[model samples]
Target: MRGLFIIGRTTAQSIPTMLGIIVISFILLHLMPGDAVDAIVGMSGSASKETVAQLRETYGLDQSLPMQFWNYLSGVFQLNLGTSISYSAPVLDVILERLPATLTLMLCAFVLALAGGIVIGWAMAVFAGRWPDRLLTAGSLLLYSAPNFWVGLMIIVLFSAKLQWFPSSGDESIGAGLTGWAWFLDRAHHLVLPSCALAAFFVAIYARLTRAAMLEVLRQDYIRTARAKGLHPMLIQFRHGLRNALIPVTTVAGLHLGNLLGGAVVVETVFNWPGLGRLTMNALAARDTQVLLGILLLSSVAVILTNLLIDWLVTWLDPRIRS
Candidate 1:
């Protein structure tokens, strides 16, 4: 019941937040020097002044900014995000087509980073000041310092180009008639590189966060009491130290979802992955305002909902936060 109330309140608060993002994104996109018509005309290589004027009118880009905003807001209320000039489809429909791939990529990356970080961090904490800790810390720093795109390119060059280990580009094999587990395996194979590229930076961040939190929690009075009570070191560390240490790690993970989404743009572009990130880059190049706006709104909602989920997880993990 309390969880439901928290979810409701959080969602209510996020309504204005999403609206603000939508308005700001719309205004900023319009302020840029190009529109969907410009992208279309550019793509065609030439257009007469009259043709350009007609295109603008067709796209309703001829309206005043205020009118445009009003119309867009009204449409938003009705769940009409407008049509994509590039894709020639309803904006929502276009986004939906790409959303599943993006979700899959993000889910894989999130799970890898969170799970890998926690384990690495726990190992580092348990072996503080030892060789394992030093080695892992240095690796974490390297991963954190490296840009995700560069890492992605390197992975492709080494794994795909040199070793012939993984496909360099795409989320799946085109035209493959594989089914059931075979299809799932094929998709997973394509996913490995992109997921690693997207997750590398975040894994480092979570690992460092977890290590610090674990160290702090391990020094607490209860931890000392557990040790004095002759509790097994592994049992105390996992059940007590790690559990308390997770609160801040969970908070940071929630906030980083936005960054993760942003990073996916570069990773997807690098991998030619058919995800929202790749679609976003294409939309930007074409100055497709409708598509851009739709993606932004959806991305914002995703981040918001993810943070809400994180809040629930944190609340469940730490009963004190419930107060």
Candidate 2:
């Protein structure tokens, strides 16, 4: 009951924040110079004033801004995101179709990052003040500070172009159907370079955070008590120190997951992955208001949901948070 109440309150608070994001995004997008119809008509200077007006009316661009915003708000409640001016498809349909590929990539990257971080962090923490710890810390910092696009380019050069170990770009081959193990393997193969690029930054941050948190936890009196009682080193670290150390790491990981999805624009474009990021870029270039708005709303909702899930996980991991 208490947990449920907390969750309810959290969700209630999130509503206004989400609304603010939508409002701000809508206003900024509109304020940007140039209209969708103008972009569609192009610079050939052939479109007449009558033709432009007709196009604007057709796309509801002729309506007052407030009225347009109101209609959009109502449409959102009905899950009708309007048709893309550019794609000619329902915005929601286009977004949903691409969502699975993005999610799969993110999930694989998250798992790899988490596992790698824990192992490296644990080792560094256990061997504190040693040369190995210093080396690991230095390597982590170097990777953490590196720009993601730079890392991605390096991966592409090494693995895709030079080594020819994986496909250079795209989610999968043109003819690969979405069924059977062969299809799965092909998709995974294509996913490797992109996922690694995405995971590398997270892995470094997670490892450093975990190492620091574990080191702090290990210094506590309780940890000393566990050690004094003759518990094995592995058991002492895993059974005692790890759970406590994870509170901070979990927070970082949750925030990173939100960032990964929202900021995948560059990485997705680099890999030519047909995800929300790529779609958003194309929409922006074409001034497709419907598609842009849909992507913004979807990304905002994803971040909010991820935060909510993190709250629940934190409450579960540290019971005092429930109160």
Candidate 3:
């Protein structure tokens, strides 16, 4: 609201927030039933105590908890997210490799959800108390209450298993030598089911929120005044009402946008898309602490950035925010 200074202040707060997440993730992660060395040994069936001790020392597991945390913090400052015990790669590299797929999926889902919600919400508000409003409310409520994983599964069953319209799993079809626009189209083809699955719940939420906001705005003195002045209904609704309604919508968008990333874990798992969600799953299974911490940190950063972006946008849209 205060412009660059406010945004900068908020951005600075991210350091401590990220540090807290890192600390918590490091501590709780170590408390898990088995260590990375144990996971490695389990894979090979057996190992000598000497070999185990070496692995422990190698990973700095032998150090005191405070020391280990200090070292990890130092590495974090240097952009070293430590190493993945299972992947035998830097944590950042592993996450970055899979990041694009997750980003693409979330971005697509968010745009679709935001656009659909705005349109359906405005329509519902315009036809408030009528059959069209009732129908939209009923449908949106159903979607909002439904579990996304179940929705994703059903979508797959209907669209892929039955209709053969989309592949049920994976980011892309294997061995298809498509290039350029065709290549993008191929990726988009694989993206539809998962993105829709992720977006469905968000669309419902946005629609309900938008409808409520607009209806409230429509009841305000200014809106009534505009109507009394002989303004065109469409122009008043769109330019006057909708614009004011959007401030609250922007708040909701900022708060929940990061949720799309979290939701991607489930949808990605359901659809087998290579993204941070699936990577988180695999890291958890393997007790890959570095990768797990990296992902959690990245997720926290994303949420913070989203909130900052929304703050700027809301200020631009409503001067009251600048106060």
Predicted model with the maximum TM-score: 1
What ranking emerges by TM-score with the best candidate at the front? 1, 3, 2
Q: If both were scored by TM-score, which would come out higher, candidate 1 or candidate 3?
A: 1
**Residue pairs that clash (backbone atoms under 3 angstroms), model 2:** none
lDDT of 1 by residue, 55-147 (tens): 888889899999999999999999999999898999999999999999999999999999999999999998999999999999999999999
- Please give, for residues 182-264, the per-residue lDDT of candidate 2 as tens digits: 88888889999888888888889889989999999999999999999999988999988998888998888888876787647
Q: List the residue pairs that clash in candidate 3.
A: none
- Error in Å for residue 132 of model 1: 1.1
Sorted on lDDT, highest at the top, how do the candidates line up?
Answer: 1, 3, 2
Cα error of candidate 2 at position 168, Å: 1.6
RMSD of each candidate relative to the true structure: 1.1, 1.7, 1.5
Task: State residue 87's C-alpha deviation in candidate 2, in Å.
Answer: 0.8
lDDT of 2 at 206: 89
Backbone steric clashes in candidate 1, count: 0
